[model samples]
Target: MTQTTGTAGDPPYLRIVATIRRRIADGELAPGDRVPSTRQIAAQWGVALATATKALTTLRLEGLVEARPRIGTVVAGSSPAGPAAPTAPTARRRPSPAPDTEPELTLDRIVRASVEIADAEGLAALSMRGVAARLGVAAMSTYRYVPSKEDLVLLMADAAFGEARPADAYADADVPEDWRARVEVGTRTLWGLYRKHPWLARVGSLTRPLLVPNLLVHGEWMLSALDGHGLDPTTLFDIHVLLYSHVHGLAVHLELEADAEAATGQSEDQWMDSRAPVLRELVDSGRFPTFAKVVGSFEDGYDLRLDALFDLGLRALLDGLTPVVEG
Candidate 1:
């Protein structure tokens, strides 16, 4: 087991990297052994997810470890340099000022940097200090453009929502005349955005919605599709929320699955495979005959496809709402 002890002077991530490196050097963790995952590191070291991610990232950059599909990060079979003694903690170094030739910092630049960090790593890995490091600026320098991390995140969400316009999807082609067709176009457009930026699904919810202008563009598109149908105002809005909920509800899992994979070093399939024994035991029990029959009917194991589920759910929902919407 890796010890959590470290000097106060070194950054948390660097201390973690140093500890793991020493383990490799000492053969305590042999080549091909799985490294502790980000979740494990965070829990063991009492640090945030961002710090744990940074530690793993540093180790990967140094050629000390490599990520394997469904297998988590492992010690590199051959490191660039043989494992060496862990260096003692040193004072934290200040980030160098951007050179005279570097681009001037602006609010737009800050938001863009924040979005990039959140996109590449999950939102949990995003930090103001990390953004400053990415831009090669002093950590406090970012505060001038964005008042606080919360404000920066709001700006990031707005910028991300503004990326695609719902109307733009049908711009080149003629807009569909049927209300259902238009609704399909608008809902699918929103789903596409969630796919592009999985972190977006985590931003807001039905109780407290994200009130950004770009997101409103999508709402307007959906409401307008049902405008002339003569449905009551409440019913019209209810239908709109129902459709949005379907997309948002399913899309929320996109980021969650990603985090799960990173934390456990297992893919969805691998995770399900690991649970097969429990499933088999339940099926063998006489208490759930119907459930057993349904499960046993599958020649090949069930594959949970989010895209397929989205399509199926959308079709079913629209079918059920057809009478209410048409009346």
Candidate 2:
């Protein structure tokens, strides 16, 4: 399905289909990977939804993809044909920054551009040059506001974290909800935001935390919620930190799955389906009794449900804290 020619001669819809087909042919798009939604394709390629739909329909017609009920459209099979061309280059050479627009390269603009870039691609594809190109500015122009790519990334990370802040009215409210409940609410909100912007988990560092005000507010709220608990501030902070880490850690896998879906067009379920034969073989060996038993049951083996895990972990952690609070 991979086309050697670029988009020049191909019709818009055809080009889109071919590009995705190329990704599929390469290892980039794997079997059971989710295809980009109509809305996503439109936004990403700057095409109309009709055009995107046509392209997606083309994929379906060619036996390359199938629609999954919950996960959307994913690659139909595991062994896709090899791509005729090289992998798509994420970066293109940039000209100089426009002098007129030079003064407008503010931190906010820079951060927003970085987010947009990461939103389209994964965080690994994000770079100063990439952001600058996305902003239609020279790479060096970004450094005027932020000294280095590292600094720009830190700013981008903080800006992303700050996106989950509650309104001032809610911020001031002294609700009677249990501290654990409050923390869980905040953590879930943060996790949802991360789901929206999968790149957020790439911002590393537990200690020497970034000083973004809104992000600090999340920490402040977590700390304040634990006030009545007898645990010292350090221990209280650690728990919240651990909670954040748990969400962030799990988010990385979700992000990768998202990337795999986008890059390969395979849904998690589709992936599991394609790998089921191998998995069944391993499970049949009887080397791991508990795991084998779990894999034998579709209800246990193929659950894409995250709520159960999240709820279970939250409850277990809170249960351990109940004794500390009561004592």
Candidate 3:
């Protein structure tokens, strides 16, 4: 039930978030308990779905709620001092960086700030001014370390890619049981990184790749695993590229989904609901008998389970490659 909180001045989403946060704090919502989802919050609080989405995002940023695939949001073990607000200013006012008591601005600081901005608002909303505000520096201060937004984005992608590596990178004798295991590790690691930093999927094309050294580390890991097989160099690298593409191609949708949400002010579930009539009409039309028959059979309808699709594609791709590698 929506509360009658007199939230006269504060934003509606923030009020909903505040209510949910209170529930978590009062032990009404235990850790691992299913917290109200965006839709549920919208219905309960009588707010727009967009408002509800922003509210859940705030709770997520605050570390009070965490989203689990297919399970909805849940309470985390503890909440930190709350993450920096993801909401970017609508007006692009250029302000001198505010001084903080911490150390001077550095490359690491610049890249981290850039990543945070891109993560929250998306790449299009990112700017030197926005990043400067984030770092408590002047609008132009970021220019000292990174020349342009494009250059800074390259650095951000590189830093994010380097954040994690396979266990074999550190171990002397430890290795996966087989080549497949090794390849699985590399593929999943790349996918996980994309999941963490959705913007990474949009970086560097295949031919005109991002010339970042850290990203090359992942390449080295994958190539090394594929080397000993009797396959020709062309086939070997081709297979490596294929595996990477499978993960990379699907990952692009992650950023796109975020961008769509921002532009439409509607969540994916909401958008799908809006398009339900057209989908139903297409099924009902007698033009495509086979299509209608297949879709009609789904009790719950087709859920676009991307994670499951990634696994499904990977297994099929590897199965097709087994002969090429073993041949």
Candidate 4:
């Protein structure tokens, strides 16, 4: 699609803001009509994700649009100049409610609120102040419960990891007899958690792992599965780490892709499509015959499905490890 550009001298984001404002003013986008998402705005306006986000923020502040959970940004019911609505400024200026009206601030509440913010807006948008803002308390209020942003993130990761109780997955009678089956269940459970909270993948890494108790529960489950196999400690632990790394290594892309999409305003498919010329040039070079042949063999272009890759990698890992573990 052709990029929308505003007046020559205007800033890129302002141009985007003006374009959307005109659409609303001209009745093209009515109240409750969902506006283009940040990615869409980025692609259409040929601007960065930050620019698109800024344009939307401006619209929201102007009372021209409102963000609806699960619905996205939509045109506001009232005009921007109408009676002052409960916008950001209004929310910021809201008088503190009576002690009875305000809910008690607890560590759990603070962590949950922080997770919600991270989940909805991403980890980058998460801040101590933002958490407090979301919780409707003083910025310093969250500090009383959680020492700092780092500590809060650790708590959030632990809480998220706690959601899936690995031990509870297999009850007394329902436990899988085969070690491979048990490992599969454990790994898949971890994968499911990562899928739910994409940002969780970015919390820690292989070299510097998250030492939270909840995360260790999953580790315990995996280690327990291979316990009675009579394998040496080093080999067994190596196998476990390998399996865990397979899931984590692939899962890291989940958040990275989301971040890239937000920053570039291009979906994975769009990004790949834009690289078609590069791919074509590589294929035409004749130096990479095998790569070209494999790529050309696809009836349709390859789509990188992470879920499928996870399953394939898991099976292959198990297959390779079977001989080693069984012996």
Q: Pick the candidate with the highest TM-score.
A: 1
Q: Write the per-residue lDDT of candidate 4 for residues 1-327, one digit (tens) a residue.
A: 111224445567656766787788778999999788666676787876555666676677678987663235689997474223233322322224425334588898989877765664567756786566556566577777778899999999999999996657766757876899889999999999988787898998889999999999999989998988899999889988998999899988987887777666678999999999999999999999999999999888999999999999999999999988888
Clashes of each: 0, 9, 3, 0
Instruction: Give the deviation of candidate 3 from the true structure as CA RMSD.
Output: 8.7
Local accuracy of candidate 3 as per-residue lDDT tens digits, 188-300:
98898898888888888777778898888988888888888887899889998999999999999998997777556678888988999999999888999999999899898
Each model's C-alpha lDDT?
0.78, 0.68, 0.74, 0.78
Cα lDDT for residue 308, model 3? 99
Better of 1 and 2 by TM-score: 1
Best by lDDT: 1
Candidate 2 lDDT over 1-327, as tens digits, reads 125334455567767877787778776878977768655787799976546655665577567877553255678876445234544443221223467557767889988866765665566555665566455566567777888777877787777777776333257676545776677677777777777777677666577566666677777877777777688878877877887787777777766776677655667888888998898889888888898877666565667566567668777877887777556
lDDT of 4 at 128: 81
The regions of model 1 sitting more than 4 angstroms off are: 1-103
* Per-candidate alpha-carbon RMSD to the true structure: 5.3, 10.2, 8.7, 7.1
Rank list by TM-score: 1, 4, 3, 2
Poorest 10 consecutive residues by lDDT, candidate 3 = 86-95
For each candidate in turn, the TM-score is 0.77, 0.66, 0.70, 0.75
For residue 142, give model 4's deviation from the true position in Å.
0.6
Which regions of candidate 4 are displaced past 4 Å?
1-103
